[model samples]
Target chain A: MNGLSLTDLTWAVPLPVVIPLAAAGLALVLWRNARAQGVISVVALSLVLVTSVALLVAADDGPLVLDIGSWAAPVGIDLVADRLSTLMLTVSSAVTLCVLLYSLAQGLADNNAETPVAIFHPTYLVLTAGVANAFLTGDLFNLFVGFEMLLVASYVLITLGGTGERIRAGTIYIVVSLLSSMLFLLAVALVYAATGTVNMAQLAVRLQQIDPDVAFALQLLLLLAFGIKAAVFPLFAWLPDSYPTAPAPVTAVFAGLLTKVGVYAIIRTQTLLFPDGRADDLLMWVALATMLVGILGAVAQNDVKRMISFTLVSHIGYMVFGIALSTEAGLSAAIFYVAHHITVQTTLFLVVGLMERRGGSTSLDALGGLARIAPLLAVMFFLPAMNLAGIPPLSGFLGKAGLIQAGAEVGTPLAYTLVAGGIVTSLLTLYAIVKAWNKAFWQPAPEEPREVALPRGMVGSAAALVVAGVALTVVAGPLYDYTERAAATLRDREQYVTAVLPGGRGEGRSADVTDEARREGGTDRVEEGSDLEDVGPRGGEQPAPPEEETGSDEGTDEGGTP
Target chain B: MIDTSPSLALVVVAAALTAVGVYLLLERSLTRVLLGVIFLSNAVNVVLLVSGGRAGGAPIVDYTDEDSMSDPLPQALILTAIVITLGMTAFLLAMAYRSWQLNQHDEVQDDLEDRRVAQRAARDEAAYLSDDDGTTTLEQEAAEVHDETGDDGPPSSGPGTPPSSAPGSHAVPTPEGGDAR
Candidate 1:
């Protein structure tokens, strides 16, 4: 165990969450000043981005741990920042920062300069905090709390303008989310009933000991709860309806990030708690159906926002496919796909926001000759649209390539079908984007404005995001390597369990995993005999792998140069 | 099933509440749906209680006579769930009230676009199911979809449709009124 007194637990672990949370409280008090709100939101998100990047760097050596109130492992709510979480946090914060800039520009353009909607800043910050918390939390209960934070903030964000449609859509969104959360709560209760502890680390050990039938049933409940949130297959009815009606920036943020949070939670629980890939055949079927059916729905839509909303639902299948495979390559590709999708998705939505501003509509039928009018907007839309549709040399294609490669490696008949389905979805996504393009950008001026003036900041934000999407390609090699290492960590479920519950077997259980036993130099703050050692396997003479992942120097070469 | 009596009673209550709740959820009325959600959530809470498996003393054991502590965590989880459910229910109530103020009823209306999309989907599915496999482009299908009820096609230029509930750049209801049902 990392020997530590109360003082040993520190800020490095919780900074990403705490910074925004504290800043949100500050923003709430300063809500009267639009300038203050904008500055506060921007600065707060910037801090989060920087801290998340720093956390990602720090986590390379080992998983960073912060036990609140100094209550150690399985007993207290611990926050862990390992490779997967910090990667998500970093990308999400960057997207949020850009979105904040875009929204501030929107406020200025809307001529609400003085009244600059106070609620948006605080609520947005809270939502970010909730996401960060969900990523970092070490227990199921705290994960539930993290989800509620998201709901509270999202409910406010979804209905910010108080329009009839926004409210109506929000009602559907909230009701669906509430139902999912209720299921999640019930799942948690059952978990506590089955295992005496709510800590994920402890449950990992205990769940294995429970009857296979009981474990499988519990797994299904958890899957069902998160599946709705992730908008998988039959559970996805609410997303397309609710998402398209929000104000453009809100819709953009929601599109870019929200469902990914659900996906992240699913990945964590599936990988950490249940590694056997239970009913994986069923999951692959669901993934294929989700991909094919969702794209068909996207094809049916004529509006840009609605089309993207449908695509958002569809792409979730890709990540789910990775999860279903339950291979190291599959998990790694899933992580890569998530990051790639987030950037590309957010950029496209921001472009939609711009298109809505310039042409006065996102309805494809009502829009034409946008390229002639606003070529910059067209380029912004073009690159990401191509990227999203899996055009070559872009991150989207790269991500799909990785997933398909993984699927090929799996080589099962079902996996082959999903790979084929994935290719179909990609083509349909491109087709959907092109349909929007023909109507909104390329067609002769059915209704072209004499002059076009865009909010500079908003355009800048969108451009920045588009570049970030491109940068994913630029650094695909490194990012893929990182994902591989992260996936490697996930693949060795016992590594995580042992890391979280040190000496988990008993008082004198020697470190069995050789790799973990070797990295003593990097281990810090492990206590020799903390009082919290009452449960689980015991003694460790040699230090544990303090650095979570040893450098995957080979991954760089294997991933191939970008 | 150590505490068979209460667990059995609770299970029955859960089944009944969930059944009624689900039945009410099928109604078009928003209030009914809201009530159903509440009932469903409450039923889930009771089920959560039963999952704790038994009733015993406090979970605190000082190592003397430690048999069972009634698993206080589920009770705690149930408390958190209740608070969250209350928050959600209150929000639902507010939405219902607002809908009433706007439309004079809380009967949820179908999204016009969603209905159109579904109709198109059914048509496409039927087309796919048929042996011909016509291979109609999705763009063609999307463009061809028109309300058979004598309404103008979307990108609607009818000059009568209110902007209300029309999701577009111009979300605010403007006097430019240009399309209608």
Candidate 2:
């Protein structure tokens, strides 16, 4: 859409990851000055937000690939800014920016007690960089690296101040995350062994030639790894148990961004590598369970934070449901739902933090009369709460409507079951949210409500997030259109493959080495009807094993094995 | 093309390491869990080594023919995984040490909030038990679900006391901790 060239846009692809990382180091150096750390973090995240938006616009024309250090595809790692990734990056950066502002305000208001400025600023920045890297990376191993970057930072953030309770929660979170990382590593190793390359676009081309069973195994392993991170049902127990213990902004950011990254990975791989939809039925069942069981857990909770955490797990099912359909409408709606959930969930947590402050406790039994006492907090809580429940005229409602409509278009028995399950989940979400609202805002106070003064910075940032969620509803038309185009690009795998590997080779200096090597090695080998037969010296005198040479030769001669 | 078959010995060793690591991971002690994490990551790293085509000459382009060279990519990946595991090992150890200092034990504690939820469910179940039913009474259920963490009410300010009302526990300690809430 712009007058800029692909090379010019490609250069900006890595900045979202690099800027925060550089600022993280800078913040670490100035740790003694909390003000400087806060300013550096705010400025760095704002820059990331800006770059992500720019890429989001530029990628509308086509996917942009940056082969790091000019090493070429299937060899060097690459960072791709496609419509799906750039959109996710934009939403996540905006959410992270808002969370950063809120945390900065909390740090300043607390004089940096609960969150030590020295460690918090650096770790938070690293977390943002890791998230950006995850969204942008076109290499599977780099995605794993991105996950580790964030998880390690999250480990420190979760256990900040070394509180006994936090330490307990942090251990569970860390061990579980480490185990998932191990599985992901093993999956990466297997993918490399099976396909001989880790670049996703190349994998998209090569995986089609591998044994279908092995590809299916790889898919399941990857799903298992990401499922734990995403907190899907049966794997979601760790989420509500650990998340409520951290300070508010930390919990809010984790609630909003972390699991969605896992969802983003699932979307990318399902569409790009394994488009046959072998796992769609399985994903459908899993999504159904995640939705029903999560909301059931939410309904059973007596604490506001834990209740919200359960709902967070419940809503992840909706996104997975969309992916399971493997339809354009399904994917488009899933993407829209992911964007909506990130903002609304984060806003709810921040609002709950304010409620905790006003009520003197997060327990439903202890909190009461907050609607009369803090009318502003009540309104803040009400808007996002309703939006999360998929109330009409809200983004949440529009996203769910899209998913249901997509399911109806499919019209399978299971699809119908999912549609029914989805509606039930929505109703349950409303019930759970309404219950918490009634107890926290409407019920009579057991004791006098606290007169604590909510900091203007914290309230402003949280309010900004709430307004952003509402704004999603306001711009739902254009955003949905954008997601529809993104899903179309995702569905057409050739666009991604060709963009990353132009003309049967990556647009890098070293890509010619493989071509030259094949040419030199061809004199002694028999031609097997290769299109490269005319390009090289073909001989039939010495016939060699056709299997292995065919793979390497075809891979070089024709980027797509066919 | 190079030999792509992995050695059976490495595969067997990796399987054994994973088995033992998973067993240790099921243990309650943080130290054992830490060891489990170490063993498990190493097992995956070894698998990574095996995933690269069978051992060949050093991968240096000039030192070995292209056909005989080992795939260098998996090795690079393994190095990255090893470094990450090392950082994680150090962090987990520090956390284990801190846990021991605070609670005199390195065992991962069952979530107190989870226990409370279970206790509440049990109480509701007891309310359904008839006079002649064999189900346990409310008192017995409470004892069965009781934990070391206090269950009386909201947490009061003091050192050495478990924060019974753990959710929003920071709300009550604003003065000492300078909590933003």
Candidate 3:
């Protein structure tokens, strides 16, 4: 294997998953001390961030795979880190760290009881570990495990204080997510039973050899599982209901991470295992519907949090549109869109939380005159709101520009429909944001008022996110390049396959043996007669091989070809 | 004996649960709605389980025959689903209890119409008072002010009541026949 020792393989792969998981365990043990848990959690996440960066640097040209305990091929547990996964890990870790800090500040300012504060750190650490695991895992079943880890942590974080509103929202969130997880599991089982393998690389190799009809069924099942998680079209009703009810930091992290995981899985599955672009036509239409329906929901909401939540649903359509196209540019655009949306959407939600705090309520009727009293808050809210609406000089605009450009490249009637949907959704999002601004800030205060104060830490956290949103906009060019690289890597599986299985090239050469060894061992092998009986003739002299060798190779190959 | 397939039976059960859940969700009682959510979650779980296909054999490692292994992926997935549902159920129960305690009732009503009516009445009262110019008669003004303030002061000048100084003082309605007047 490329003359590498076991030490290099062991150190390279497991750090990203292990650091946060170990920290989670440690956090749980120290759960009684809130401050200690917070410190430990932050340090753990920071380490994850460093490891993700290191992984990206180390895997510059190809993916990295680790088989746990040195087990070979399909039998072992594997962790794979491709460009897309590394990028996701980096972004997730960064966003999670910011949210963790925000939560700590919020807990201190609100003087939340000790128990809930203590629970927050451990759960947050687990959630981080889950996100890392989901991105890094090479097995379908392992992905499911990662998803469950994150979902459970999110449930607790969402319902931590157990207020009536939070509990209600958390209930809906948990039920919907649970349903999706079950679907994912069923899909994995079906695939495993059909193929007898779950390793993504091996599955990619084997699935292409299966029957067309069976492959189609497997593809559909996988789509449904990821679709439910991603909140595409008919599957998205629970998002708006549950997301807005949580604390601002929790909602921010959810907005940033949860749905994006679904998108990541979809990208991986579609690009790697199933490259039939036509199969995604159904998804394109569903993407359009998701965009239209979500924005309409946003238009109907009076609560600030719920409106943002609905808008989150609407923006998911943009990413789906990119995936549906199944082209290099399309995938690149989708990746860029995901990164931009995570920052913009999370910032907007956090700002909404700030608005709620300053105005004494999230309801439009209870809020007004915020601009007169809190211009900084208004500016923070205004920037992300405008960005989310795809205003110029913002990351949101650049992401949409890339998507529309990709849509135009496809040059189909359906493509036009998606473009139209994108435009309409953007307009509706603007309308929603403006409605919130007018009612929450620009209008005069109500006749009778509840006195409200904006906490310094809350403002600070929001400011940090707003700056991040702006930075994304400013660095759009570089970000696009990075995403394009990731997209290219996804489109060309050769680099990935070779990276995982060294010596994948050169047929007839033992993959585990070096060229030097082959040269030295050549003398011993020359004495063995060449078996020509198994080698079939190509309109030339007949080549022969033993019956066993000929029969097994053709048999397995025939069964494998879909 | 019934000849239905297990997959079909699972589908039927899911449908029934979903219908019941939807019906309960429409009810005004919060507790009923919570129960409805629980049923709906169970229905979704059943749907997931059925989607894996009919039961086959156990998915144990080292099994030689492929057909003998039932899909283990669904079981693993359902385990997580069960845990998530438990968390949700607990949260819903807590929320329902809290709502009951706060309102002393378990029902949630659509309050938009009632609130609208109250707003309209308040606006009408304000408009009625503001219609006249500054030259309101003393007795009429006093009566209007008393209505606005929800006071029950004396109807005429007496030991406890101040005498009206304006020329239209007699216009004030007497307490005994105020509505008749």
Candidate 4:
């Protein structure tokens, strides 16, 4: 155990998640001094950004698994940094750092005594921690903890000012989020009940042995939980209702990052845990509906914020579309789109915040002439807006084109329908952005605009993201390679299981297994990809008598809730 | 694996609580909704506990045997979830109370814009389809036409009309222009 040099970089895996959590605690302690909080946030998030990059690089070398307190998988909490997780951690951490800068700038500029500005710094840090943790955790229970941390932080951030509207929105947000979280808990419990372990790779090994009907039921339950959080069609009513009411920076980060986490979880669980593609057909149809319905919602909105919120929901469909294809190109496109969407969406929101400062309202009915007054702001808005709408030479377009190519590769009726929906959604997203543009920037100001000072920090942070969005296009070749590798890793789940749980069962899954060996047991538990000996068809079934067993006592030793 | 009294009672109680909570959640009053959330979270906690299987002896055991001890993981998860739910419920309660203070009642308000958008999508295809500019006038006209026809989905009918007949107007349900009011 001491001689194992392969696990060297495992210690660095959770730094991005940990540093921010520590910073959050520090910021909370120093709550009175906003300046100290700002310094702590920037320095901590910058470090996180650096660590994530390192983690991603190290993961590319090989998946790095860190068992909490040196306890191994299926027992201790695991933090794994495979290509998929590390990539998400890297992009999102970078995004969070930039958003933090923007928020700090906004707070300093206002000098508002009434708002809980100090609390913002800590809560925002906590939110970033939650996001990073979600991207990094190796087990279901830890993943749930990560989500709760991030979401609770978001609840505070969402209702920061405690305004009537903000509070009302917060109520809806918490209620919906709680519902989803509860469902996720139920899924976790059931998974544990069925399989006796919540380690994802262990589930992969054991689940295939379970009855296909029960396995599919579990898959649907998990999908339903993630689906609500991801804001898919018919479950997206909560989003358009609540998002527009928050402060600009809060709204920006929320719009940019939060839903993507859900999408990330969906991508992770669907690929890693349930790899048989049972839900692919259902996901494809939902992708079409979500794209159409979300964009139409955007097009109908008169407020810029609301429009973007709907457009955000609409664009999530593109990612889901890429995911549902369950192919290498498709998953890679989905990953690329997720990264691209995060930057572009956040940039758009930051730009919207700028418009609010200049025009005093995000309502299209109240805004105009920004093109003449703040051409830079208009540029910031236009670039990401066009990118979001998937114009040529932009990252959004490139991502969409990849997904479309993948869909065309499938050439099935549902695939074709999704392609059409993709095209139409992109067009409508463009239309919605343009509508907001025509009203908020191009036309004459409806009333005299407020002469407000645009904070350099807010604009600068926003511009940095805008530049990053453009940079994504400039570096699309390399980025696509990264996402491709990530997606390839996702498709070949065996390597991930092997890397994370080497000596554990569920290893050597990719090797060819003979038909005779699979049918040897004559029970339904033969999972073809896995090593035949590791998990027999009924190898790790729950004891049913969970008591009196110290073997799997990890779940039994509950402690340290803060 | 089979029925145990405590676990069975817990499941039954959780089910009953969730049903009641969901019913109140669907109501118009924010305060009642908060109560529903409270009940629902408590029920979820009960389920979390029951999910660990039937109650057993303490988790700690000698080397000889600890197999009958209750699972500690679900309890931990329940603790964490309960703490979070309590905090969130408090936040919701505060919001509901704030809304009550701001207005005279704690009635949960519908998001008028979302309602308007949905109604327009169903009844007035012209308004829903023809908007890249999001021209309020075009939508207003289509909505009026929709009202005149009183279409299958919903119309911009008068205040006294049923929800299906007047969802578009019922969102604001005021003399105010569209949902912007």
Share of native interface contacts recovered by each model: 0.19, 0.32, 0.03, 0.16
Model 2's C-alpha root-mean-square deviation from the true structure amounts to 7.6
Mind sharing the TM-score for model 3?
0.73
Off by over 4 Å in 1: A1-10, A112-116, A450-452, A504-562, B1-6, B58-68, B118-181
Interface RMSD of each: 18.8, 11.0, 21.6, 11.5
Task: Tell me how many clashing residue pairs each candidate has.
Answer: 22, 0, 12, 12
- For all candidates, state DockQ relative to the true structure: 0.16, 0.26, 0.03, 0.13
lDDT of 2 by residue, A1-562 (tens): 2334553477789999999999999999897788898899999999999999989998998888877886655567888899999999999999999988988787777654555668888999999999999999999999999999999999988987667678888999999999999999999988877766788987786667656767788899999999999999879989998898888888999999999999999999999999999999999999999999999999888778989999999999999999999999999999999999999999999999888877777767667889999999999999999999999999999999999999999999999999999999999999989888877798777677667898898899999999999999999999999999999999999999877754443343334653553354343222211322221111111113443454354334323312
Candidate 1's residue-wise lDDT over A1-562, tens digit each? 2334232223667877787889899988986676887788888889889888888876666566666765556556778888999999999999999998998887887643111267788889999999899888889989999989887889988866555566667878887887788788877866765655688977776677656566777788898999998999999999988887777778788887789888998899888888877868878988998898899988877678889989999999999999899999999999999999999889988899888778876666566789887998999999999999999999999899999999999999999999999999999999888888887887665544556589899999999999999999999999999999999887777766765664432222123332243343124213311211321121011112431121132123223421
lDDT of 3 at A326: 90
TM per prediction: 0.83, 0.88, 0.73, 0.84
TM-score of chain B of 3: 0.57
| Candidate-wise lDDT, in order | 0.75, 0.82, 0.69, 0.76
Task: Write model 4 residue lDDT over A283-402, tens digit each, in one string.
Answer: 998899999999987877867888899998999999999999999999999999999999999889889888878877666765788998888999999999999999999999999999
lDDT of 4 at A29: 88
lDDT of each residue in B64-178, candidate 2, tens digit only? 8888777788889999999999999999999998777666678787776676667668656421222322323432433454335435333322211122234233333323244
Model 4 docking category: incorrect
List per-model TM-scores for chain B: 0.61, 0.72, 0.57, 0.61
- Tens digits of per-residue lDDT, candidate 3, A5-112, equal 442333566776788788888988876677888789879888888888777766655666766665543455678877788888877787887777777777777754
Q: What's every prediction's RMSD, in angstroms? A: 12.0, 7.6, 15.0, 9.0
